[model samples]
Target: MKIRYKRMHLRWIFVFGLFWLILGVISITNDSENYFNYGYLIASLFYFGNYFFKSKNQYLTFEDDIITLNNLIPKKLNLVDLKQIKRSGKDYILRTENKELHIKTKFIDKNSLKDLKAILKNLQTN
Candidate 1:
């Protein structure tokens, strides 16, 4: 029916942005003559702005032979066209018969993968 996906982790971005911001502040305080200090501050601001505004939520759903993927960016795919499903390390690949579609699973747990496989199997049999 409906499956909800998770949001991207912002902790790393926050940490990196904070580190850069601190570095820039320290540089500005220590060397008032260098323009590079202002450059770092500008760069840090850009990173923070991008991190907060542009990130999207990721999710996958299978319903009535169609699989809908919403990774903030939206995609609609028909499960009937799906040719193969495979697991490669942490990612799951969904290949279509036309080779035009390649769906990758994100933030899916072991139970979710099992559930998806079961759904696919039913689709194949019918």
Candidate 2:
């Protein structure tokens, strides 16, 4: 099973990046010498580039009892080796004897969150 990041969460990145890009373009066209507009333009590019490069890989994949975190630094955890599952604020921390993995719930879609909770519940019980 693969759990995806919420669409709304990804949508916000585009919204904010476009908003800043528009503001920067408008300000530039107005012949203003404000350095802040340049900053905004640069920041928007960073946001857009980040979204384009990383968004597609932002998900959790579970296969054959191994969980793969497909983020900046990909990680895999064997479910059978997980020693503890605990909630820390909005994140779920899964611990093994010498390793820990954090699941950021805020970026997960609602239905996926429910499914993830069910999966974790089963893990906790076993």
Candidate 3:
């Protein structure tokens, strides 16, 4: 089976981008007095840009016996080599015979967590 996972809440990026755009417009309009700082607007735009690209890059794919996690930083782990899977606070920790990986689940839904747990159980059984 193929399982495709993507980060949720992409609209937040658009909303933040709009906020920055508005701030930039306001800053430009009131440039004569120079009371407002353009740095906040620039920083917000940068943050939105960063999030846009970073969120687009974050995903996890599971197919056959392989599990691939690609984020702003990419990592790949083989399911066949995994020795243990457990929950740690708000995260999921996957431990292999030689290495360990921790995935943050603060944004993962309850249903997704249940599905993931079931998958882990199946993996551990065999």
lDDT of 2 by residue, 73-110 (tens): 78889998999999999899999998889999998989
List the candidates ranked by TM-score, beginning with the highest: 2, 3, 1
Better of 1 and 3 by lDDT: 3
Model 1 C-alpha lDDT per residue in residues 1-126, reported as the tens digit of each score:
544333343556666778889999999999989988998788789778746643443256666887776544557777777777766765656678664444445545456666766776675677
lDDT of 3 by residue, 1-126 (tens): 322233455566667777887887777787846745676577687778767765654445567777766565657788888888888886778888887777766545456566666787787788
TM-score of each: 0.52, 0.77, 0.67
In terms of lDDT, model 3 sits at 0.67
Which regions in candidate 2 have their CA more than 4 angstroms from the true location? 32-37
Candidate 1 deviant stretches above 4 angstroms: 1-8, 53-80, 97-126
- Of the candidates shown, which would achieve the greatest TM-score relative to the real structure? 2
CA RMSD, predictions in order: 4.7, 2.6, 3.8
| lDDT, model 2 | 0.86
- Candidate lDDT values, in order: 0.65, 0.86, 0.67
Please tell me which model should have the higher TM-score, number 1 or number 3: 3
Q: Which consecutive 10 residues in model 2 have the weakest lDDT in total?
A: 50-59
